[model samples]
Target chain A: MSNLKKDSLFAGSVKDAAAGGLVALALFGMMIGMQADVATGLGGQLGINYRWGAVAIAVVIVFAGRLLLNLFVWKSDKPVTRTVGSLLPKASSFSGLGRFATPVFLVLAVVLPFLLTYFLGTRGSRQYLDLAILVTTYVMLGWGLNIVVGLAGLLDLGYVAFYAVGAYSYALLAQYFGFSFWVCLPLAGILAAFWGIILGFPVLRLRGDYLAIVTLAFGEIIRVVLLNWYDFTGGPDGLSNIPRPSFFGLDFERGEGNFADFFGLEYNSIHRIIFLYYVILAMALVTNLVTMRLRKLPIGRAWEALREDEIACRSLGINTTNTKLTAFALGAMFGGFAGSFFATRQGFISPESFTFMESAVILAIVVLGGLGSQIGVVIAAVVMIGGFEFFRGLEEYRMLVFGLLMVVIMVWRPRGLISVRTPSISLSGKAKGISADLVQEGHG
Target chain B: MSNWDNNPVLAIEHLTMRFGGLVAVGDLSFNVGRGDITALIGPNGAGKTTVFNCATGFYKPTEGRIVMNRANGEHYLLERMPDFQISAKAKVARTFQNIRLFGGMTLLENLMVAQHNPLMLASNFTIGGVFGLSGFKSAERKAVDKARYWLDKTGLLDRADGPAADLPYGDQRRLEIARAMCSGPELLCLDEPAAGLNPKESAELNTLLNAIRDEHATSILLIEHDMSVVMEISDHVVVLDYGEKISDGTPEQVKNDPKVIAAYLGVPDDEVDDVEEEVGL
Candidate 1:
């Protein structure tokens, strides 16, 4: 537009290009340069090949890319950020999007398995069906952790321990007592919730990083106990032949009077897979529904108040201990239900299945999904788990790509995908019709 | 005690609070009359807030008896009770000096959270609420009505939907008082409520606190540095110097007390007459 503006833009672009080029040179040079390569190709046998030429080319490409970005993307950053920053305050204050997001996501999830079956024709869509199941499990886990980390503002790094508790409870009961999957589902949840309360008591006084370390230790302690308690927990070998949930007491086994006969349809393994998908889908929806409802309750508001300021909540006469414990217990309850489903689906689990990495993945889902947002958790689970499943062939680079995507996302939206919050209760629901003039007319 | 009511709603006897090596409050003794506005005035860091914290059970007194007598014929030993019990059981409510309202929550939700104990019981531990039962539904409706009443009283009914943190400093102060009032406490303890308020907001706060005392019949123990607020609304004033009561009487008597003048001016006892004359006491 102006001479000064144009000159500054050019100067800034040059600076950006030079900085990007230097960074590229340093990174590529260390990673690719000065490395030993015994080459058998390019007319060489057991010869060390220097990649300085390739490294230079890469640095040049990076410089060009930065220059291009500076001209287009970076140039637009000011207007874009200005517009976004201006719009976010109004958008985040109160929006209709938060109300409709969950129902829309629920519809999509309900039709996902059917859609995959329709497009890929059931047999070819087995992997997609399994991926959907996996995604829903994480969605449930993310929603569960959303209660503690998002709503209550408690950093629980060992949430997977509750999952382990549920899975193992189901596994042990089914294996020892010959219990059905349905019989052990509630039992698993109860047992996991019991463990949640037990773990909650000692850490009630701890907050922030201290609480995180204690919960992390609790997770690891559970894993170690499961690994060493061989006689009771089946040790590292893990319990097998865990019973699968039947379709209303109808088995999917290949025998007379199986699920197919009961339904008067042809028997196929896809039937069981589809059934499992629906089961977890139902579980995830229930978790979402319960969390949404709880967000409106007194205890739910107490949890949020506690999150905002514990001393203030206590000063207001809220029982901080009960609030924190309820958050932990309820979060663990959902994790437990999901764990039971995980056990029934896999039919086997060991200490390796409930490692610290699992907790990290679930925590990442909640964080990246926008903490306290149910629909955000669903979308994030689909993106992360579905992306991992789809990129199975690129296994070596999957984590790197995933990490880069996460960094990019954090840079783009530090608060996560749906950071805007909608208050659970409002008096504005009535104030909408009343005029401000009338309100001011009566006031002193 | 000649013309004043003898029954005290809160009595702090020899209340001493120590932090390892330093004594924050030492042998402080005071009584807050029923339905009276009692002001606790002192210089900065004179353990004014420490006494409020001890009375509200935020800090346990090292060796003291802090007793609260509720109108319902219940007496609570505040030092022996947990912080929440001091408010919920002993009917004591408090506001923070820093204005610790739930920032992310709406103004209405912030007020509703103050009435958590009763609603929690009515909701049947959330089971009835989740099921949308008639009892819990009515209770929720009542909670909303109560929150709206407070919102209207604080002149925040129009902005009830906005986040509490988005409000300006003065509105936030009013909302904090409104939130504390929603709990319907017998004794309200406020810590520096007029710290950053302008003159107009301060006058408005004075009217509100006077209304609270006359109409709500709630006793108030206020920790304030604003002498205008203290002299305007306080029925009795207790001046503290280094965690000990230096003067306690009606505002006129305490204002003209020589020890209070010495404490306020940081002067020796012999120089109090000259300092009082210099300040036109």
Candidate 2:
């Protein structure tokens, strides 16, 4: 310790910098050393400009940065570094402040648009409202997928297939039968659930990785079928001009009997936006309410039991086959509801909207939130959707930043940001939170 | 004695399980007497687990049927039933050789899950429960009370709120037994319940098993390698060797049987008589 004050921090960093400089040189040589330019315009002669000076400077900077990092961080036992981990709540239970946290967040969510409206005016708040709506959509999707992936421990890579089914069901029903959004909503959920059962039947005996592969294949099949079945699905062009959901048949636009006219207020575009946001919020809350209630019910307990050990569940007299199917169906039904909402919100229908990437993002939210944790999903959804909005300006580097954030989260909390499985019931007349280590992440 | 010749709780009639030309349990027949602890003991790979699997509906025997008779006069063909139905309808609950407690769930939740069938009915498949129906709530309270009873019995009432994974090894073994009891079974099957227990823990297990049999009126069928546990608690013992029953009698009678002693001592086929004679048989 006495000798370190003399040369360890300074001399040790300098010694390591030579190797760091060599690494930086290898990395930045092609990145900063060479540049290609078109001499004139579109078809002009291509020229290669080589400037070794920039590369040398980049190497120097990297070396300098490495040296500074070592001196400040690596060399010191207690380094001065900042982390956002402290800002994140433990979320172990709704023990103390957590009970109020949900209601407080709900109240805030309910008042957010109005708050922005009062401050920035209606038109200015539209962007923020749209972002909130997107966040709510993911929250709804996350809760839906949580029932399958989180509760039942079924790795469903084809969740978007159900979402697409719901969207297409609503679109097709509205187009062909002239059904209203109200009529098609339940129909969409039912159709999606039906497809879920169809998928469930074949994969009854499969679990873990095998279940995931089959589901991935099923998702691709749905997309490819939609791509090829031009007459039925409109192929690559997709169906557009999908009908928007009114305020219970009271149109938001100007007419003989419109929402604004009925309310005696001047027609504002933000009204529909606000209405859609509330609709999504209400739907998300319903998903949460149902999931919360189900947790105490036998069906939900069976799902958790099945997740922990299927053989044990069977031995304990849980009908695992039926339990797994119900998980698939119920999860798909909610996805269907959100998909129909997506259709109405965009006033468009497209197979592209329900890609594997969408499924991955939704699954990633459930996982990153901590499986089986309801509040965790909400936090993950907001951080994912809202954070992406914040990172949109990064453009080319946005994906790099996103990947870095995921890696950081995984490193800090491998289970999740909020990885606590609170017991649905407690013997002490109070809910005790099960710590993350005790909670199974599930094999799937 | 409540033997199968009079009133058997479970009867295995020539049960045979073949896995691709290799017979795991070859034409095994046994009777688990009503309200009696029947021990099925064997050396390693003697198909004790295979028989348990067949009886518990994990495996379908190539031949023979298993009949289970409940005290309420309900008789079931255990072989024809599904895995869950064996426990749910036939009233047969079993613990695995490996402790299979729901690690992520609280001990109470694990026990609660065992009472799923009855609670599922009372909840009306969750439609009534979601609306907070009084009927469902009362049923749930009753279920919780039952779970509490088992947890208290296992001496884990103080730690019921904790996840089952947090339980120590000896506690987990007792928890598995507690979980099985939560199902309200007329017959309980335990595979290697004393496999990894200390002497004190093993003695405690003996007490619990005996209490379950005496007080609860539940018959027990166990596969054990622990002779002390078997001899102390078993009312009847069935000895198996190479997928075949070598001896079957009361523990005292079975212990003195030369064939069972030969099987346990691993005497050669030709030296069975010589070994018996040397032991002063």
Error of 2 at B79 (Å): 2.7
lDDT tens readout by residue for model 2, A1-444: 778574867888898987999988987888778888886755688987788999999999989998888877778665655334455654453334346667888899999989989998998899999999999999999999999999999999989998888888988888888888889999999999998988999998987899999998888888888888999889888888788788867988876689998999899999999999999999999999999999889999999888889999999898988999999999999999998999889888777888899999999999998888787788899999999997899898988899999998888778876677878889997656777787665555
C-alpha DockQ of every model: 0.54, 0.77
Inter-residue clash pairs, candidate 1: none
Q: Which prediction has the highest DockQ against the true structure?
A: 2
For model 1, state the Cα shift of residue A271 in Å: 0.9
User: Which of the CAPRI classes, incorrect, acceptable, medium or high, describes model 1?
Assistant: medium
Consecutive 10-residue window with the lowest summed lDDT within model 1 chain A: A435-444
Model 2 chain B: lowest-lDDT 10 consecutive positions: B272-281
Candidate 2: true interface contacts recovered: 0.85
Q: Using lDDT as the measure, which candidate wins?
A: 2
What is the number of backbone collisions in each predicted candidate, taken in the order shown?
0, 0
